[model samples]
Target: MVASKRNRVLAGMMLAIGFAALRSAPAAEVAAVLRAPDFKLSDQYGQSLSIQYPRESACVLIFADQRGSSQVEGWVRPLYSRYQGRVTISGVAELSSVPSALRTMIQGIFKKTIQFPVMLDWTGRVSRQHEYRGKAAAVVIVDPQGLILHRETGKAAVEALERCYEVLDGLVRTEDETPPTAPQDGPAVEQAQRQSRQNGAGGAVRQSDQAKK
Candidate 1:
């Protein structure tokens, strides 16, 4: 009788452990850090984007809805333009935080206005993972290789965002450091190609002469 009871207790413990494992959600956000919770989403252009924050270079991410979408063009695009290929710019549409009735209407408006990759956080899973307190929006600047450099919530003014931009600029590699790589058709590569062709021709001629002998 004791052996049967022991087995039943063990089985109950196992069942509880399994249930707890199943009920767990993704990890919560790590503040002031670039251990950015990964997310896969589609943008307005139907482009599939997977963000693993703190890439090779700095990146700026905006989590918002229609409330702050309009201002993206004003301040955000300038960041994109200033940084150009130096920094990454992305946005997340926090539709799950919006009212059900207003979701569609807000989505339609931003879809037309936003230029950069605005990922749809449909269930707010991504937002929750990032711990986005529901404000008009939240912005984070991460340095290259993923360190949270700056974070802001609400309508962060252009000047204030620019101050954050300077932080990102300091982290970016200088032009002399990260020059544009030359194409394969550059002078050095073209010279190498010419030499390769000459070597092949010489080898063929030598083979023909030996055959003639």
Candidate 2:
């Protein structure tokens, strides 16, 4: 009788543990799904821009301060070479610390240096919203609806780039594949192209090789 009573207690404890785990799992998942905050800021050319989510392709936002800006090219070049059409890549300069008086000079410098549009964050509000790390560049990947799929902060070293690649590989589809029932013209075709590039055909393989070099 004592053995049976002990068995009952053990079973109750196991059930309680299982229930606790189940309760916590969803909270963790919800916490992980951080949605990107939307805002408009002028680019290097002084043209205003904002990330309109639920876009045709996934978006990559690279946030950097003066120190972190040095690492931007290491991440951007390879990523652009391989996933240019597959993803929308943009840069955000964390220039909130710059004095208001020097803003025009800074913008001019950016225009001269960067060929692409880099949204200038004069107020720092966007940087804070995105949790910009001042020490290292923060690479954030957001899906169509602006849900942040992946984020990492550090130098764009090979290993770090590989990790980012892995996240992107999971999110983006290859160029050739298409859904059977979906129409070819609109977002469905775009969605179909967002498949895994590693599993894609020869052209994709060539692009991947080029990115490594």
Candidate 3:
């Protein structure tokens, strides 16, 4: 009879512990700010970057193409120039999105000319997920809170550049702000198509999970 009582007590203790464990289990984190999908990419300088999407500062993510590179570069490059110390501005070179044969020329010659940080998206995963209608030449301007303030097709026009600046004009502080890069308006769409024909960037490059941390 005493052994039976002890067994009952042990069973009751197990039930109580299980109930407590269930109660103490963590809840899923509710985001306080609009967040972008986390991305781990290396810069041209082989520096690893950790991007916590819902960051405190605003950022401009420009996925540039070689054809519309001059125009898009003209626009987003200024953000880095103006807010070098403040904002998270970068031009992610969608190199992997291009033909593997042309990667050398673009990365070696064209991309090398840029003054700003033109990151290498080797797998093309990030660019593909956010590609604008299969067009990789795109730009996304986000606010300090991480809300997408403005976005444009990779080969959008001069007016789109204005919309982008209009969003940033009120929020950021820049001591040496400059104007947009260039104004290649006509045949912009055609140029984008022609450029993409040359670059056959595709497939999800496999990366190890350890790369995340």
Q: Estimate each model's TM-score.
A: 0.58, 0.68, 0.52
Task: Estimate, for each residue in 136-175, the C-alpha lDDT of model 3 and write its tens digit.
Answer: 3667766666566566664445566566666666667442
Ranking by lDDT: 2, 1, 3
By TM-score, the better pick of 2 and 3 is 2
Q: Give the per-residue lDDT of model 1 (tens digit) for 93-188.
A: 777756778756766765787555578877888877766766466777766666676766665576556666667668774422766777666889
**Among these predicted structures, which one has the highest lDDT?**
2
Q: For candidate 2, lDDT tens digit of each residue in 125-156?
A: 89899877587788888877788877777677
Q: Quote model 1's TM-score.
A: 0.58
Measured on C-alpha atoms, candidate 2 has an lDDT of 0.82
- Model 1 score (lDDT): 0.71
Candidate 1 clashing pairs?
54-146
Error in Å for residue 139 of model 3 = 1.5
Our tally of clashes for model 2 stands at: 6
Better of 2 and 3 by lDDT: 2
Lowest lDDT sum, 10 consecutive residues, model 1, at 25-34
